[model samples]
Target: MTNTEITIHTDGSCLGNPGRGGWAATLRRYEGGKEVKKRSINGGVKHTTNNRMEMTAAIQGLKKIKKGEKAQITVYSDSRLLIQGMTDWHHKWQTNGWRKAGGKPVENRDLWEELLTVTDELNVQWEWVRGHAGDRRNEEVDAMAADAAYKAA
Candidate 1:
């Protein structure tokens, strides 16, 4: 298993509550002047949340890499809430049996747990990107996600 570092961009969109939603992830690896781009999408769901889409993007991206290969991935997303929850509050939630403080069940616990499992399989470094503000790759992913959501509707 060769160790390769992949720069990945991800985005997700939801049309309305219990409405259409989608998530897209793009993986790019540059060798000299050549860049390989691979995209994946998840849709076809009747009811979903934007957070679920966001988490799905990350999970799908991680799912692409082969096992036992060292992957250094930088995942870009505009969702600060998702990033913080994964890097910060997840520990507390797990210790508390996936419940938040005050003993309330956490939102999207299933997706969060799934994401954690997929991410743990690889070496991922999560980063933040401002959505719809002209980052070309991120914008492309945003378009893909929106289209996927609409198509699934």
Candidate 2:
């Protein structure tokens, strides 16, 4: 069977550094060159940081995948922190017990761990895009996250 191709676009927003925060993800499934399914999800926390929200967007997006299925998944985000941490720092962090340089614990380690676990289960490709550009899907998710944050405020 051919591998299913799933594309998820994600974004996060925070009112303030330690204020209301929100995350959004848009999932699209393509089979045989035709789009099959699509979904959008978003949520917020009463108190959280932008980094936490960024990690939450990725985790929540990956969590939508069906279990026991081998799929080629690509996650697109604007957060360099999330993209870099997952693609580069994850291995080092794992070896260091989630600590960064100077033995400092990684922020959003909880969500990072969860994202790592979820992405490991699927063939995930991490993609970084410029934010606030003309990417419609990214813009949509950004708006969603912002609206969710607004509601939580």
Candidate 3:
């Protein structure tokens, strides 16, 4: 069976650093070089951080793929922390028992572990997009996240 191809754009918004926050993800599937299917998901919490929301977006987006489905997924996000953590820091953190430099336990370990679990079940490539710079997909998720945050407020 041929592996499916999917692109996911994710974004997060926060009204306050530790206040209302939301996350959004947009998933598009391409078949035969043509757009085939698309979906958007979003949610928010009464109190959260932007980083947490960012990671949540990624986790939610990846979860859309069914278990054991074969797919090549490219995940796009504006948060450097999310991208860097997945591509780089996660290894070191895992090696050190989920502790960061200076021996501080990794912030957002729950979300980080969830993200890792979802990613491990799929073939995923991480991409960083400059947020609010006119990337249509990225902007769409950003708006969705902001709207969700406002609604949750």
Candidate 4:
């Protein structure tokens, strides 16, 4: 039996911060070359932030993975906040009991908790990419997210 790894490219878009948003994720199975399974979803909260959209994208991406599989996964996203928060800030926050510096409660604690829980369930490698840098895969996810945001509005 061969161990298979999967790569997921993700992006999120918002028409206006605290207005409309969309999220997209593309999963490629590493068996032959790159067999893709793409997913995009969007919704306008009437008042939602870009960071929320970005977080939503990550959560949605992780949700797509099948259960009970020993798979190595890489999640690529353009949101530095999402990547850093997940890999770095999350630990700090947890140590502080989900509070920010000065002992203030963390913003978006619910989303962060969900992200942490889901990520912990998977063998995932989180990566950050520079948005709009003409990276084809990145750009494709971005476009899908943006389109979903528009159509959902």
Candidate of highest lDDT:
3
Tens digit of per-residue lDDT, candidate 2, span 1-153? 555799999999999988999999999998876789999999999999888888898899888897655768889999999999988998999899889978999887788878878876578889999999999989999999998888884
List runs of model 1 lying over 4 Å from the truth.
1-3, 31-37, 40-42
Which window of ten consecutive residues has the lowest lDDT sum in model 2?
A: 65-74
Rank all candidate structures by their lDDT, best first, as comma-separated numbers. 3, 2, 1, 4
**Per-residue alpha-carbon lDDT of candidate 1 for residues 38-132, written as tens digits (9 for 90 to 100):** 55555545678888888888878777866654656788899897778877989999999999999999998988888888777677788889998
Error of 4 at 129 (Å): 0.6
Please give the distance, in angstroms, between residue 151's alpha carbon in candidate 2 and its true position after superposition: 0.7
TM-score for each prediction? 0.87, 0.94, 0.96, 0.88
Clashes by residue pair, model 4: 18-48
lDDT tens per residue, model 3, 16-69? 998899999999998766789999999988999999999999999999988765
Question: Candidate 1's error at 58, in angstroms?
Answer: 1.1
The lDDT per prediction is 0.80, 0.89, 0.92, 0.80
Off by over 4 Å in 2: 1-3
| Ranking 3 against 4 by TM-score, winner | 3
Indicate the TM-score of model 3.
0.96
